[model samples]
Target: MDPKSVRYISECFVQPQYAPEESKQPFYLSPWDLAMFSVHYIQKGLLFTKPPPADEQENFIGGLLDRLKSSLSLTLVHFYPLSGRLSTRKEENPPTYLVFVDCNNSPGAKFIHAALDMTVSDILSPTYVPVVVQSFFDHDRALNHDGHTRPLLSIQVTELIDGVFIGCSLNHAIGDGTSFWNFFKAWSEIFQAHGNEACISQPPVHKRWFPDGYGPIINLPFTHQDEFVIRYEAPQLIERIFHFTSESIAKIKARANSEYNTKKISSFQSLSALVWRSITRVRRLPPETTTSCRLAINNRSRMEPPLSPDYFGNAIQTVRGIATAGELQEHDLGWAAWKLHEAVLNHTDKKVRGFVDEWLQSPFIYQLGQFFDPLSVMMGSSPRFNKYGNEFGLGKAVALRSGYANKFDGKVSSYPGREGGGSIDLEVCLPEASMHALESDGEFMASVSSSN
Candidate 1:
């Protein structure tokens, strides 16, 4: 790691405003709420990067931290109505805790990995109120080893990769993915332009913004009846990338659209449809089983005047499309595409916003789980892939992959710049056998080769 670089590490914490026993009411955190929290956490990861110089690192990190500390001050407040049961507030504000990890004693990679492992464990098992911030220097001899071999993020210096991997393990009760990424991008731009007097102007905050109702609220109907409650059950999904050129994607979209006699479909829509069909074919679930597809949507625009991209808050919502197993089995790809699009459109309405508000105001809010399983397909689109720009004053990044692992039953993401082109990069998580089968298929094989 460059000695001149300074690392910025931070974590977010949720302070339970009300104790459950005092209220004597059943309160639960919804999966959507958990997702909202996730957005903030993920953004933390995105905003972090290696500073330019060893000497400037500390200053950069310190300045960025100071800015964030000030901006997040509103979120740090005591609770009201302390006797009520703990539930998510429409305006639940959580504090973002930050600490600087010292990498002086070990290689940066090792230090980061150790820090991440420690941080994740700590967040998973908080024992105190408001969550204390922990900071430390790595003193282990393991720093002498090859840092690249480790799973942690690291910086290489003098053929010896020694640096810190600034990380955070935030509680999943604050924001979802979109919210997280927005905050991250803001942080990155903030740090990058640190010391530039004009850049010091803080972005506007929109607390009243919420997710537009574009997708089906699958959990709503179930939660209302007091039947099967949705819980966070980590699905068995894996994330992997499938490379394809813009031309190939265009061909696929054209082919599908021609067959269905529909308007042009987006890369995301087409790929999502493909994966949805493929997963159904592989799972062979019972004919009676109902499968739903859900997608995460950004709600920054839903707010009045729009939430600033740099607004360090959760600004995401999810939409779902459901169909019976029989429908999926009998419907063509066009049908699936239409359904998915419909779901997307439905969630974008003002009425959906009302639904979220009503749901939050429900009596059985706490009974809901932090995670929801929707036949579990996860997809993140258009991850900026200007790898050539990541030259770091060196050459372009030879390869880049979002370090996202598929933890659900179905996961797919479309990234940019595959093999250096304007093509849409795809990562699909399916059974290894299914991947192999797709690879063996002549058309798929041809597409893959052409993409390369």
Candidate 2:
């Protein structure tokens, strides 16, 4: 189908069904949230076969849209902060900006109804991700900072001839992958129960996590937008989803462990090591060139006084495992996985506290493209997230896809496979040539059971 085939039907702000008086106060952003102020918005989407046909197709679509929008409103009651916009106040002395969620105004989240003339196979069976899929999202080239004016969360429900795609554009400053999926799960629960609040088993915790002595509002050094150098322009690349079956992942983990003579190698670490090595080799960088794999680690349970699993905000840190290209290429998969395992193990509670302390002392924001080197890989989004568990009445999601928000060469997003049982689907973005080379590499293709 043509990329422009997606047509918008309706758009509006989806407010909470009932906003508590406490939600009227400005929601303070934590240091973790402020650090991601300039990063790209988190864009994720789910695909499901169309609900059982109705007498009139247009009426069916209308009914589906109403159900989604209404359930979203009820979900927002618990996630009220998502309905708010980012607010900022500038101080002159040192040229600082105080950023927080303006919950008082509650601008509300954006809900869009769109239609696409395509089949489920057109998306699930594609060799490379369809460019038109990017159009499903609300904000194409937006950053989290755009939340100041735009909705902190935007949901676009695109009706397909044979399927439906529910896309979300969430401000990264407000939450991470964990928080994003939790909100989605809650919405799906409400929608599945025909908009019943009793369906929600565990409500999300809206209280933001902050280090002691730190604040609900964090200050940034930048006085003007020009001072921030975040660019959404990504290098030309091809994106593909590689799926590893449960058995394949087990084989990979066993191989890594056997090679390293240890049983501690995890499935994720092994998988990460394989991708890192393959990408580095495909790039064919200099032997001495330094290549790193940055892993986004969740700090909820790692904190001294561990934060709740339901904490609804950014609580992640990107920890990097470094090695030279020569070393990585020469070493076995077990060696590389061990390095990543060590990196993850080493991020102890003390280290988490140290990072918070350092950030509190000298607050600095992350600039887009600075998180990974040109030859590095950044693995984000966890396979542990229950992607397929979101059954919005029709059935479970058949496929998971991401958008053009924070994409870059070597950026990988992991999702739980549709078949589950410890399987993983990695959405890999890489330059055209590098992607071509990766597809031909036998060592990498061996672990990948399928790709699209």
Candidate 3:
């Protein structure tokens, strides 16, 4: 059966086993957190094959969900923010508002058990990502700000015919990809420990990071919800995961370095250049038209004092490498890669602070087309995340997939290949016609491996 024909078995809230006394106070969202209010939740999931036997499948699923819920409850003891909801305060002078997470009366994270009549191959075998994959996640259209009324964290464990898909929708306002994965790893650790919380190597540092003289509570200029709550309707596009082997990435990096006469060109820069150039060539835009590749930088280590790696909440800034369509097509891959390298290297601590200062001076929400226009690309979700290391006792995940939230033209998500060893999977989203063109482009397809 189609994946959309999913049957939801049960829904329940899994609260923390022990709520700390400090959690009674509202958790103030920093400027970094507020900046993500308009963005969608981080919808990522893992795929696993080899489910229990058909005869014992019902009991197996029930026991699995119960264990997951119990482990999640234990995990939330430290990640209590996930159980909180967004709250607002009406400020009078200057007519603005304040947003914070009211952690006092915790509603807990939503745990949903669902089943779909599909196999693991139904998802991994497709050239283009299946549209029905969106159904595996809860809060399909929710923004990070929706945490006010909706659950901040929602997980859907969907049982397939021969596999299981663990899909999670975490409000972006609460954290970034780093925090999301940290929470996931910790939860899996607790689960694998069989309720032994001592297995957690390092508890997350929930203390939010803030620059000196900045704030624990940031104020926004929007007086009305409509001014900040903008809906994102993605354009007609197709998403395809292009797998690049470790050897291919090295070759691309080598080619870029050879042309540039420098070994400083990183693999990521080379890959970004290749895609940017390839897409520009296929688009055939006017000579003077400008194209950009927006790269999201993790600011944890980039800060002056350096934030804790486990510091929960958003600490990211986007840097764009802009070039004319003709310039990209006319120049060599090394040239484009150099442009991206300069952009990344120049985003120092001063630049990161400058970005926050500028945003603070004039607060605004990010729209879907804000940085990722049809002619521009936005690269997010790094390949360095522990995609396959997440072991839930069922063995490593077969694949990593994301949901429909925040997907737009020119949006590209990077993941580590299943085989690891520096391999990468680029989940590229482009307009239907452009995707067709990309598939037929031999030069681009040459680096992509046959297997995903």
Candidate 4:
């Protein structure tokens, strides 16, 4: 194999002899389950300022692989009574297959571009190995007519543009976005530590324990109670970057507070409200038309004991808020802000937890699909300062954006300090016409640019 060719690995686990009895209902892995599952699928693409001399490139990859082999292990959890059990947590032992690929012949930029087009389904097939290769291309050459530059992951080479893009398409049912990032951060930390003299210990691991008797249940809506539930399809969501100053965000927050007669409004509240209003305007839906927005609120605190960073499972719960399209548009920004904030707060309350626990415990878990449809808009806020400066030691990232989650129709994320000094960078994905309508609205534009 060419030293620079990508390598692929696959691994599998057999069911454990002694396991818990499986439940007779369908079960979904939490966010933590997804994160732990991802640790086994780590693929790092390191871009150098310039490619090393030909003699050194082979040695580099070999060394990296050796390091990885020594540092990782797989664990499996099993639940038995295999048939007709919906709530059964089956065995989840990590597989033994590990595959690698090399695209030394192609430029790194080209390789990454090609990889992006490969979806999760394509990557996980039994026929193809989990690795790929391509050459890196010049950043300027990839720009669209609109002057927006694509975020390319490239490996820099001297004679030719040599870059490597590495990816692992994980199952979404196992975890949410926050859980995914956490795993990536941990992987990065481990990779960096291998090259340094300082020893960095692995993140702590949590046992495979679920809430007591927390099997699947269903809830019902009067009108749709009898309908058979179908799998929800992930909507086509796009990602775009928006630049705003800290000052602009502050001004908007202040205005929101004044309008609502509330003591304060957060930056997230202000921006989300503006986006909500802008979306309604562009959709040309009346203010009174019913629409719902869902915000992903991290539920790390809600567990009886907080989950550790190394816990390696999904640890998020979403909170939903509903309003008429007109209510969001005609009301002052503060009103929307307050409602969004309250929706989040309400989910965290003990009563809410009790309610969710009861609902999940009841026969209603299986029927939840019949009663509630997924939200129209999905918005998330990354931990502010951590996103922009993700310096895997190559200097700060020039751009940061969220990945497209398969389930949401519209998605938005906030990145801090892209425009300098506490300013937030926004990324939104919607129909092109909707975007155009938002750009032309004066109040919407001003609110986004204002810093309270």
Native-vs-model 4 lDDT?
A: 0.42
Off by over 4 Å in 2: 1-4, 52-57
What range of 10 consecutive residues in model 3 has the weakest lDDT sum? 50-59
Q: Could you list the CA RMSD of all candidates, in the order they appear? A: 13.1, 1.5, 1.5, 12.5
**Model 2 lDDT tens row, 335-439:** 999999999999888998899889888888787777666789999999999888887766888899988988888999999999999999999998888999999
| lDDT head-to-head 2 vs 3, winner | 2
Please give each candidate's TM-score: 0.55, 0.97, 0.97, 0.60
**Cα shift from native, residue 258, model 4 (Å):** 1.8
**For residues 1-452, could you state the per-residue lDDT of candidate 4 as single tens digits?**
55333333322212222232332223434313322221111112222222346335655434443443222111111111111111212222431211111111111111112213332233223221222312212222121110111111212221213322333222222334454454445434544565332233434343433455642221222223122223333343333456677777788888888999987678777777777766766778766677766676666555556655444344555565678877776688888888877887677547435655554444222222232343345566553435443334334444342222222345665556544677776666665566667667888776555321
Model 3: CA > 4 A from native:
1-4, 51-57
- C-alpha lDDT of residue 406 in model 2: 81
Residue pairs clashing, model 3: none
Each prediction's Cα lDDT score? Answer: 0.40, 0.88, 0.87, 0.42
Error of 1 at 163 (Å): 10
lDDT of 1 at 345: 65
Reference-based TM-score, model 2:
0.97
Q: Please give me the total number of clashing residue pairs in predicted model 4.
A: 76
